[model samples]
Target: MLTQDIRQSAPVTPTQAGTVATLMIEEETTISDAPLFVPEDIGAGLLLLGLLLSPKPPKER
Candidate 1:
């Protein structure tokens, strides 16, 4: 989400007072699958995780 501040120069009606307004802007979106973490990526991540979690041999004194 994004936002922008907008100030009115003058009020439309004599009885109304000028006011500041906030204009909400939509966040940019990309079509890339990296952020989505697709199935294939999840699989690869799990494989890497398994390798990291594997037990190592005891170190000799």
Candidate 2:
């Protein structure tokens, strides 16, 4: 478990909260002509599925 002193670092003030909120709103309003998603090869998915289906090794003592 973590100690108490490590958890008492600086907390955000109201002023900082307002600034962060403003920045977030500004970012949301901006739009880009860039593509949102890129298409991947079918083989890539197969490779990942193969890895997930493979059996794991026995746990070490």
Candidate 3:
């Protein structure tokens, strides 16, 4: 419901705690304070998460 409203809103803003995240994807988005996480950055972050979650070798006691 909220997402739908945001999607339909003329201007959208994403806030966390009290600060807004800046959006860099578009000038028309109007989410200037919204943090912009680029596709490449998100991909890299997901890759790092996968690596961290993968099985690890046994450590010596």
Off by over 4 Å in 2: 1-8, 27-61
After TM-score superposition, the amount by which residue 41's alpha carbon in candidate 3 deviates from its true location, in angstroms, is 3.3
Judge candidate 2 against the unseen true structure and give its global Cα lDDT, from 0 to 1. 0.82
Q: Which residue segments of model 1 deviate by more than 4 Å?
A: 1-38, 57-61
TM-score of each: 0.27, 0.29, 0.27
lDDT of 2 by residue, 1-61 (tens): 8766656758899999999999877755566688756556577998899899989988999
Best by lDDT: 2
Question: lDDT by residue for model 3 over 9-54, one digit each (tens)?
Answer: 3554445422443343334645468677778968988999999999
Query: Given candidate 2, what's the lDDT at residue 59?
Result: 96
lDDT of 3 at 32: 61
Q: Clashes in each model (backbone N, CA, C under 3 Å)?
A: 0, 0, 7
* Models, CA RMSD each: 15.0, 22.5, 20.6
Lowest-scoring 10 consecutive residues by lDDT in candidate 1? 14-23
lDDT of each: 0.67, 0.82, 0.64
RMSD of 2: 22.5
